[model samples]
Target: MSIAGLLIRRERLARAWSQEGLCRGICGTSYLSKIEQGKAAASEEVLALLFARLGLSWTDDADGALHAQTEACMEALFGGDAPAFAAAFARLRAQERTLLCSPCAADYLLLREFACEADGERRPLDAEFVSFLDQRQLALQRVLEGRHEEAALLYPAAAIRLWQGAHLYARGRYAAATEALRAAYDAAAAEGYAHIMMNCRVYLGNCCSDSGDPKRMQQHYAVAQRLAEALGDQKILSTIRYNDAATKIECGDFAAAYAYFSALEETDAMSLHKLAVCCEALGRRDEALTALARAEAMLPEGEAHAPERQMLALVRCRLETPDYLHDERYGTLLTDCFALLRRERGAGYARFHLKWMLKWYKANRRYREACALLEDFPAEK
Candidate 1:
């Protein structure tokens, strides 16, 4: 069946509507059946009328208010536009709450979950939401298994996989995240879904960086960079550059890393924090201090004090003071930072910072503290 036919059937079933219920004032049951079966086409006017009766839209045009708004919100979220993402998410929440059968229900919830995480307010997933997403994933898997001609109907599967990857990646399940993103990449690439494919590739590259496979990491990054460059998407290009620089640091290419991080226009905590690392590597201690100061100034206090911001403070202390580790304030700061990382920053970042802490403590002959830390947070999982 055609993708539209599948959508109509799926939506109708979701609403518990029989063909008769849907065709009562639109078309005869026979014609509706033919349309659903893809044996006949529905005229634009008729399709719109049918969908309107079902409280759905057949068109994705700007005139279709819901679809347009959803698309705009998703775009804003992908672009990292905080205000726009928040606004869009608020509206989506209202819509999905009102209509559980909303056509883009899964999409809305997935984006909302990601936004919440990004905002540092990650909530536990609801049982109902998990059940709903599981159903959709199963349905998509069935379609894929059958090799249906309307495989495009399973396009949401790619999105589902992408978010799943993001969740795993945030939790430091780098290998699992790679698998999910790779699945998403394969599906999106098959459909020529450039935006989705590019995003999946970018994240796949990120997972590889943490996976400790330098060749694979750089290979994925190279592919993502090429695609972003070909698309002339400056935002994604910048993202690639940022990630590439971080990967370079992991690989001990400090000078090249400094060049990449220093060339970025972004002055946010994340960029500044990473740039500080690059600066420290190049022995530009003054510049590193400046970057950390700027990063610290940009962060708020209390619950809003992000893990990265805490890490930046620790880095600054390390650079400016020789006996920093022995200082109670700095020691407390490192302990608090490690706690934050373990609680909110995910496994990969937590492990990274913990190693640094251990190295610092051991190097400074703080053997007791180092041994205590190792006992408290054992690294061998």
Candidate 2:
């Protein structure tokens, strides 16, 4: 039974129409009663006919309804309900043609983009999309750089600012993203949009980590943690915990980070891979090797987690092959790995591989390579 069914039943009874009267020439009385009770699904034509008889619209506001549906789809994805997510996605695709003129069309597209990215199946941005993003980013930057108080007044919705911040963060514009995210957070807080506020805080915390502000990162994480707790959303709680562990690594708190990683229930390949890196950093070679093996086992059989495979192989080779940096085989492999990381993922991910490479370079007195790696960050405007 859906909320729509309840609404339809309530409205039908309020009009004092018997099931036989409502269904007279359109459907059987049993069918109408079943539809009212949610035991049978009503086709679009049936709903339209019934609503017309009741002097009401079948879809009150299609745009808002579509947006709500999209949000429901996203919620399923976040909760890891694959079957529900698939059904919702199929429904959205089927309704796309009807929703073409919807005011929330852009929002639906953005949500789809987010869905793809989360699944690690993101498509390359077209030139037009890139151009649109560039313009929005420029506008967000201007807002952040100029008036502090007029940001919310300038944007039509506070949530748009959060989207801008997320875009900036994904593109490695951490400082700008941090500012935009903070502004979004404050506006969401003022408006009592608790979900948006919590999300802003989480992303702001991540951006702070990327921008080298551990204090700000911790502050944002603390607030987001409380929000996640109060909201009682497992997805939000898991995301916050994952980011907290990753931030611990960024802060060089390897032991604490390892503890956090080890405590996780669902040991995904990424977490195991990170835990292996932590073990390697702490000079626990045996533990690192075991973790790497577990990570590899956790990875899907074929055509999935390619980057993790490359990384795991590289990590294993580096561990076993003495003078790995000096070896020509590993040297070429490292170059190929670096190229793949940069091209396939982004600067954020490439940095992880570079971190280990830089450490090895420094250890082996390859200061020139180490320095060059250090300078490989995306150039700021």
Candidate 3:
């Protein structure tokens, strides 16, 4: 059925009006019924009249202005101008009925979904709207759902390879992610899509960081920072700063990393956890415990946080005990940490933790446990 017809019928029913009452001065009841059933299309004049009688606005885009605005909306989205996109979207939403009944309804729906995602809102798509999504959008939906392998199969075009790289990164496949992100970066550069180029650079930086290539990581982050600054996107800039601090930690610059992490305005659970790590590294045991406590309080009690809780427990064990190296609870927590890291398939994190675990095993003369841990998690190529 036509969207207008469906909306008209729904609105009529909502107002408890019969077909005869709705079409009394607009058209014959049978004609109105046919239109509502999708067997006939109403003339523009009749459509305008029926909507006016029902106290709804009807716009047929006679001047092509609405179509131009639709294109502008998409351009803003692709250009990463969140403010511009928000304004354009507001204008389009004000003409919601007209846009939904227009030929560009699919585009409208796609824009709406992207907007919702940017706002961190997750809701099921309408069946009809889902049918309108192309491979890229479908792949993005899969990526958001953590189905990286399935999403990879759907991203054949270079334009959407960024999403493929992002999903692969989420799966801890740094090598594959770097390759995909580099290709995506070239494509974005060719297309002059600054937003996409910035995102590709950020992911490339992360891949390099995970692979222990600090030089290349810094280079990518430099480009990303420049692009983010040019685009005026504070969110991406904040992400770059957070990642830079993490790389500092990997480089053993605990004081610098601590200062950087401490300056960030974000107090989310993950950020607090990172702050705790920095504090511990700097030997600020009291401050570290405080940060850890705040982080633990922010986490909800559930299986969803089981792995994170396990990691936090290890940190706390190290903090609360003077002889954590000889503590049985520390050994148990480390064992659980390894198990959860394996289950989560976080190769990057596992590699980092494995180094510390091996050092502990060797110092304690636990050669067998070290060998078993190495066997379970081979070094990444």
Candidate 4:
């Protein structure tokens, strides 16, 4: 069926209207069905009347430039270049009327939904409309929801595999995540998908870092850094810098890590939080508390920020109770931290927190608590 016809049918079905109801006083039910089924061509007048009745819009004239610009917008979105995507989306919005009437209408709607999500303003896709989406789009939606397993099952597309690798990395499955990411990188390279390749390299670098292969991690980061520079994506470049500093923290190079984190522009809550971590490690207790407070202030009130809130609490406990082993509040914070860690689907942040907790328990001769913590989240085999 024609894309327009499919969109009409999907929208009509979403509204729970039957063909007869949709075509009443406009066209015969069979004729409408024929148009929907692509059994007959729809005339301009008939299509216009049908669209008007359904509160939709359509035009037979397709603008090639608009189509190209839409593709560019999607590229920016996928590349994780927020500024680029914002500028491109604004241009697309300026042509909204033409875009909605052109053949690119359905894709534009889907793109807008993705843009909304990227901006942290989620607008759930309609069930009927979602059903009409291609497998890749459905997989992307699932990935956005943190339903990575479901996303992995949708298709073996390169982008889907990239997300699969990322999810695996988060879950502490380093070897598997590395393998998946490498395969995805190869596929993306062959397909000339620069954005996917860059992302794959970034995740692969993370996997290497978490797996204790610092040299490999740096190599991957270097490649990703080059790609990010080539793409002119400052966001991903900053991310690479952050990850590199975090790896230094893992290596106990707190002084150098602190310098790096301090130099970074505190553009988000997590950046400030990372700064707090470095300060705490450097024995600058007061500075750490200030950064932590700033981080907490930036967080929004929602379940979505639950993990971040718990993390901030854990850090605050560390700062406030230097003698935590002898402090009653330590036990409560420890329990809460562990509970949140257990619920974590990824091991990235959890791994660091767990390490700190284990070290604290061991230094204070709390072997029993250490053993219990190990039992809850055993090290990767």
lDDT value, candidate 1, whole model: 0.69
- The prediction achieving the highest TM-score against the true structure is 4
TM-score of each: 0.61, 0.62, 0.71, 0.80
TM-score of 4: 0.80
- By lDDT, rank the candidates, best first: 4, 3, 1, 2
- In angstroms, the error of model 1 at 189 is 2.0
Rank the models by TM-score, top first.
4, 3, 2, 1
Predicted structure 3, TM vs. truth:
0.71
Error of 4 at 20 (Å): 4.3
Better of 1 and 2 by lDDT: 1
lDDT of 3 by residue, 1-381 (tens): 345565577678889999999999789999998877666888888888887888886677788887798999977775555678889999888977778666456567667776774423544354434444566566645545555557667864443577778767756677788888888788778878788899999988988887778889899999999999998889899999888887787677879889887887667777787788889988998998998898899899988678778777878888988887787778878877877876774666666567658867886889998998777554333
Q: lDDT by residue for model 4 over 52-147, one digit each (tens)? A: 888877776544787798889877765555577888998988988767766666567767776674424655465544544567667666766667
For residues 1-381, could you state the per-residue lDDT of candidate 1 as single tens digits?
Answer: 233455577679899999999889889999988777767777777877887887876553335666677777866654434466788778877776432333454455456655664434544343333333444433333332332223324444565566567666766667677777888788777766566677878888777776666677678878888877887767787888777777777677889888877887666887888789888778899999998888888888876566777789888877987777667778788878887887877766665566577876876788898888666444222
Clashes found in each candidate (C-alpha, N, C closer than 3 A): 0, 0, 0, 2
RMSD in Å for all candidates:
9.7, 12.3, 5.3, 3.9
True-vs-predicted CA distance for residue 362, candidate 1, Å: 2.8
- List per-prediction Cα lDDT, in the order shown: 0.69, 0.67, 0.76, 0.77
| lDDT, residue 301, candidate 2 | 67
